[model samples]
Target: MRLRDLLIDIEPLRAGRDFRAAFIARTVSLFGLGIATVALAAQVYRLTGTTVHVAAVSMVMSVSVLVGSLVGGVLADRSDRRRVIIIARSAAALGFAALAVNAMLPEPRLWAVYLCVAWDGLASGVSVTTLMAVVPTLVRRDQLPAAGALMAITGELGSIFAPFLGGVLIAAWGAGFAFAATAVTTALTSLLLTRLRPLPPARSTDGGDGGDGEGDGHDESGSPMAALRFALRERVVGGLLLLGGVTAFFGVPVVLFPELVHTRFGGGDVMLGLLYTAPAVGSVLVSVGSGWIGRTAAPGKVLLAAVLVSGLAVAGFGLSPSVGPALAALVVVGAAGTVYGILEYALVHHSTPDRLRGRMAGVLTSQQTTGDIAGDAEVALIARWFNPGAAAVFNGLLTAVTAVVVAVAVPGLRRATLPAEDDADADDTGADGTGTGADGGPGTPSVPLGTGPAPVAAPPRAPAAG
Candidate 1:
């Protein structure tokens, strides 16, 4: 393939100045989180060496994040997303500042750590949901996939590299410095995001469409229940979500890696770390060259194929005879998984109406996390009955097989098409400035943002791309 095909999609960055700001903010925020995660884990281990104690600290953040995600979704639908994000990120920065202060103490209080973690989780939850809700408004309809690709790439790089940098900092200075660094970055993210203009809630209001809801020809006004109802009601979206659920349940290789190192590889700690990090490497490479995938007609098919690739590669990694082959397989799994993720985000944003976006995004995040925890528990149970290797192979194979089944069953998803980009200006909500979206001829109707029930209309056929 030519290098151009593999080149990163820079259009979103070039086209949408606001998207560029959001992208930068995402990179900074994730990096800070990664650093804080490592610092927190190290601090916990220092205070109490037991694995259970470490897990306890983590659980506090997890519960808070879950709660925050739900609340953030509701808030995003009710008010201005840009303002919500600014406030949320500012709170996260305060969380890190608290961590820094606690770490600097001669003897850091364990309770303080838990408290700050909970605070951080709440702030992050709100930040994440509102940001996901805002991306479509930052870019054109056609750029949604590219936007997704950018986010996945940003997250993968941040998660992969930031921990290593944190480790270096911790070794040279201390956890206090790491926490301070994260605080500074979080502050920077908030400042940069502030440059964005105000974004009103996309929830439908009566007969008026959200003309200010960023030009996607959809309205954003509905209850959280409406978001859930839409997910179940839409065939393609439901299929994609089901796919996420299955993958999370069956994709338990990460949980098995430590055990596999001694049982199969005879490797040391460094090797184990390499095994863990391999997928991120693969994901980064594919993201760098993701332009070609965006040009394809059958995005859903491509996503299913990605799922299949991930399943097969992960299974192969589990069954490999030696370290080299297993590592290579893991690389493929990472690349494929990244593709699946980008497409899933693209489809979710493209298909869902504006009003329900935040809630839907929050729900999907919760489901994925739940699926992961459940899978880890289930795989551990299976390992108790069989060896870890056996459990890994079984789970991987199941993931691959199920992906095929789902793809064959959902033709609409395979044929899914994005709406053409339009010249809808964000400032023009309606002729009356009431936030009712402009009336495109025969376009699809969204939930009314007003007090009364809004009218629903059939959408026109999507026009060809420019």
Candidate 2:
């Protein structure tokens, strides 16, 4: 393996101008969102003087994200992705501006903060779903791993900076400035997107339909129920969704951080800051060194293993008596979590046909957001009932157990094999139900697993293993 391959892949950025634009847009927007994330919690806490109120903002955001992603998925499947993104970004920017305005008030209305957050969450869900759907369209199949890697790295880096930046802005200036900065970044994203190619839904190829992508048949593909039905029918998709849910709500420890810092660690604000930043640091290190993962053919196995590792890491963090060990445990958790995300994105993108992509993306986001809120709630509840350490250990062990059970039970996902593009031109209906053109009639074989591809000039290859 050359040293260059070990570094982050840049072909996704190089091969497609649209991908590059979207990449930059997401990175910039994430930074802004990061700022908003911190500011929102701080403002809410300031106003209410209670952790519960601060938590409410996150809960509202999660519910709104679920609603938005569900609706946005259907829209992404039926309409122009570019347009959906533009509208979503615009709405989100406006929401941020509202936050800014609310912050500037002498006595900011608490309700106004929640309102802006809900609105922002709705638009954010739309933007995230549409953007995921648009990736394969913008770049070749081979570039997906790189694209996903880039996205993860950008997000981690943005997250690392945004909190500190928000703290500085809020301390030096105020929450109003942080909110305004987010608004500006969002507006800039919309402006940058003006040059990207328009993405319309891929019709017949989306979910095994044989017709050219058009007309009323498109309506069903755009439905959330349709996506749900497909997922139930496909164990691979269902399994991945389950894994994500487990990781989100059960494995994530965001809600318990402050409590652990104050009680278990006996640390103050500085220690709390380190706890928050540790994951991003680990994620960045793994992302830049992600070349090895793409070479693995059995990404499903790898994905499950990543989950197991994450669970164990969290368990270790829970048991660690010292801050240093806890921080080390966090690094492992972060790396494992990042790999899981990359593989999940690659595997899902590769398996779904063009039409169903948007809906699946929507479902993915919805589950993830729900898990986040639920996980936080559970951890907090557990802390209240027991101790933070016990909660962490319990969740971590449960997450690991869940992964093992899912891995053993979900045969389709467990045994599924991604192709190496040897028969890219072979005509076969990929188990994904996507149709392909193959002149070699009976001799041609479909993709080994249930995953499929639709008709396209260049056959849709297996998704990247990033």
Model 2 worst lDDT run, 10 consecutive residues = 457-466
Candidate 1 RMSD to the correct structure:
6.6
Query: What range of 10 consecutive residues in model 1 has the weakest lDDT sum?
Result: 457-466
Candidate 2, residues 268-294, lDDT tens digits: the string is: 988998998888888899899987665
lDDT of 1 at 212: 29
TM-score between candidate 1 and the true structure: 0.88
Which lDDT value does model 2 have at 197?
A: 69
Error of 2 at 377 (Å): 2.2
User: Model 2, residue 65: displacement in angstroms?
Assistant: 1.4
Model 1, 1-466: lDDT tens per residue?
A: 6788677787888876787888888888888878888998998899888777788887787778777877887787778989999999899899899999999999998899999999988888787877877776676555666777788788778768989999988998899999999999999999999988788866443344432234445444434565666656566667777788887788637878888888889778988988989988888888888887666667777888998888888789878888899899989988988888777776666556666667766776666657767788898888889988788788888899988888677666666644434422332122122322332222344332121222211111000000
Clashes of 1: 21
Clashing pairs in 2: 203-213, 206-355, 249-375, 427-438, 430-452, 432-451, 432-452
